[model samples]
Target chain A: MSGAVLLSLAGCALALLGGLFASSPLSARRYRAAAALAAALIVGGVWWVADPRGDFGHPITAEAVDANGAPVSTVLVLQRDGGRRQVRRLPLRRPVDGAEYALWAALLLGLLGGGLQYRTRDVGPRWLAPALPAAGAGAAAVMFARMGGLESGEAGVRAWLARFEVGAVQSFTVPDLPWSAQPEGTVALGVAAAVAALALASALWTTPRSGGERLIPIGAALAAAAVIWRMIEVGGLPWRPAEGALWAVAGLLAVAGLERSSALRASTLVGAALALAAVALGA
Target chain B: MPRLPRMRGPWATAWAVVASPWTPWALGLWVAAGAALGLVSEPGQHPASGLVLQLPAALLVFALVARDLGASTARLRWAALYAAGLATALVGGWLAGGEAGMAEVGGARPTESYTRTIAGRSAAAHLGAQLGATLSADGAALTLAMKEHHVGEAVLPLDGVREAHIGRWALHLVDVAPGDEPAYARLKLTPRGGGDPIERAVRTGSGAALEDGTQIAVLRLSPDFGRALGPAAQIQVDWEGGSATAWHFVDSPDLDARVGAAPWAIELVEVATEPRLVLGVRRDGPIGVALAGFGVMIAALLGLVFAGRREGRS
Candidate 1:
């Protein structure tokens, strides 16, 4: 297994544990401590396993050439000294992998919702308050399903190449761009930061409500839609940071205004608009 | 009583101005104008010079957002809802039309998408170098593009191509049209000299004949089958039970034709996005951005309306 896979598994474990303990009858200090632990594990795990070159067997670099044995000018050869034992095959993994991003997304959403956890004035179902975070976590599975097995995409590419070559078989690794280099993740991150900063300023105009109960169904719906959109492969993951959060938060806020909906009309209109924007961006 | 004497300074004026909504509007207009000017300005010597323009756009957005920021319940919910709408529209529209989005490049037909394919074996070595330029789609047309300014274009009108591998990367244009069937297929030669790729009407009838001197690459099938056409012509690619895209490369413009050789065909496959959607998205991106911007502006307006109400009540 690639380190990315291991890291994601570890993150999932820690995050779940933190969520469980943070909401328990424990002291606020303990809750904060568990949350802190989860955050550290997630960050440390991603950093430790971030390198793609870490997966190769015994670092033997070879010259990449064409069928005619001519040197193509697109790439420059780089050598790295391998210090570890060789593995013949391994799973492709990345720290900024869709799955990892989904987990991180969950954490971010949880952080946003944590304000609901502070007891002081009054409280509604705190358990229900995790609706958005839970939805974010569920969205990861949808992303994985949408991305599909790495090999399947490679196979699709390979099959296409077979049409042109004389005796072509799989010769090189499929191009798996490094996580930091992927535009979607990078753009999403920047947008998320900007939006959150904006929210810190303007969100103060809003009020908090105890009706976390209503969000559960909406979150569930989002998770389902995420899977469907990924399955279609048109473009864009349903729960990407900027677009998904925008829609999710809007849905919650709109629903909050009616103390319910004026029916489901208001919520549906905003929800539909947000969904269109998200999907269209992927295209 | 103590503050009464100090309310006369420029500082007080500045405070009053800052608290007014007009401050945000003025700053917003200035920033918007800067962004528009940046778009019109000449490209800077250093690529980062263009950021001089973008900085103002960002500042405008920040100023507008932060100016109205508060901790009140009304502000938070309304703002979050509006901001969400704003973000979606902006990113989505940007993806469709702006520099950030796919730049639509197609010949006369003018589509949001053009099928991307790679041809020739030597294209891969410099795949990394050409990737940026290739992605720009500046020189992109109907044909598959290669490194440098070289282009490898094949016009297979009747026979649909499933995939193609240029030297750069694998690309597939899988159009698994409903009726998948394989019959006789042949592709003409474009002679690799940039004239026109050989053409063949995609026919799905059985029994194909391979004449001598037919230049064919039989990868899955045996080279011995090269000599005998009638019996060895049966080919099935894994993509479908048989081929729907069969072309008889008829007027061979002399492509690697070998003597005493039988011609057998291979299935075409590779990597690429859906051809139709690409064009549509590229075209629609800008429109989406504008519409989204308007939507967000409306929300902000509503927030203002609520703010006005709150002030009146207070």
Candidate 2:
């Protein structure tokens, strides 16, 4: 079996065992300690199996030449398990802009806030709670503006725009603000504004009941929207989600499910299942 | 306050250290120092070094949180799962070799095109040219076909020519002849305006400035003066306060090579290019494992939160 499939199978088994343990009413302290030890050992075993030195995957480098023996290309061949070989194309141009950095910052803030929320007592003053998410959303907005709106000069945006009824024009001209005319940009700006407004309101008016519970998911949703927009702008039409986007969605779903559900075990199972799906899709 | 029984041995010492109020602060400082060092250093030097430094801190924090929250076995199990997932992610990243690094395949040429391979995927540069590369099924062999000779193209907007009624003036490449120098391209330039069309023979790297302040210079001639591939010229048009370069391929006239942010569009047609396909792999870390770890962490954290809430209510 392929490494990803094998890992997934192992994950499924572990998750099932965890679920059974969670549901069982065994009250013996020794039994509980033994289960935890076994779990730790299982995790170590999985890691050992996945080690690169094992038979999972390895890298191979080779050079290619034309009929005249002139070097034309160099190729890096990776041998995956099950002897499956596939040729894939990577994008040559990777445009990094302020929006991408802003999204990353926002993701980090959301995660930090989530971690803080898990603490027994509040880590900081009350105002700091909402301010964190607010700052994240504000940063995203500022960066989006700095990037000359959503439709700056990316080819992906132009190609996506071409699909619309707006003739063969290279770009849409919005006299003063260039990004106002693009639908994606407008929606993204709206989402960012809304998230910021909500966070600000929470900060000034009322204390959040569940701390970062609502804020993290909303911030994640905003980040996810930006990631999806980036995917469209980079990959163009028939866009495929990149690995980063897949992980962002996985994290969002997992956190949201855990926060919303009452039963911890059921929520964990759902989160694990979603994570497995993300892995399968990303792989 | 009632005194508790004094504990001894290695396990007790470890517990005492973990329970110390200064422990989290010290670990936090260590994390901050590592992060600061990582930020000051150049990226890709040791991409995972920062993460590696923070791993021990994370483990300690996890332990402290578990003890503080009085987490049950199930919650501890989930936390272990989360740690395992994170370790797996770290291993995946270590295996992938961190960020992408470029390796020069061959020496530089007059014009070189590049191709990249990421995670077994390949893509050619957007040069309006083609480079063929293939990999064998056995993951053993790869073949690349390089073009020996190819045509080049370029386009120039007439409106930016500076001369009055220049928009009405049409410039055409009448002919390309061989010159004494291999790099020289002898070109016949015909400009049709209100008056009769003026025909002039312009050598490569040299062009005449019209009565207007407009200056045209032939920047480069691709594939030499006269070769199997049709002659391609890199032409620069400089007027009053602005300058633009365009490519003209004698073979392909329809190629739109206009790029950059300018009021008036200049079409740089096509040019001969010897493309070298260089494949580089950018490992964005083990995203799947990291994400799985994140999910497990969230699940474990939720369990702890629920437990804490229940204890508070009681």
Q: What is the lDDT of residue A4 in candidate 1?
A: 20
Q: Point to the candidate with the largest TM-score.
A: 2
TM-score of chain A of 2: 0.30
Q: Which of the numbered candidates is closest to the native, going by highest DockQ?
A: 2
User: Can you tell me which runs of candidate 2 are displaced by over 4 Å?
Assistant: A1-196, A207-283, B1-81, B91-100, B104-268, B272-295, B305-314
Give the interface RMSD values of the models in order.
Answer: 19.7, 19.6
lDDT by residue (A1-283, candidate 2, tens digit) is 1232223223333332332232222211111222222222222222222232322222211122233322222111223455433221111111223343455565455445434433435556744644554566455545544432233234433443344453423212111222212111222332333333443343344422332232223322332233333322322111011223233232323232223222232223223332232222222
What would the per-residue lDDT of candidate 1 be over residues A127-169, giving only the tens digit for each residue? 3433433344345434533442222245533433453442322
Q: What are the lDDT scores of the predictions, listed in order?
A: 0.30, 0.34
DockQ of each: 0.01, 0.02
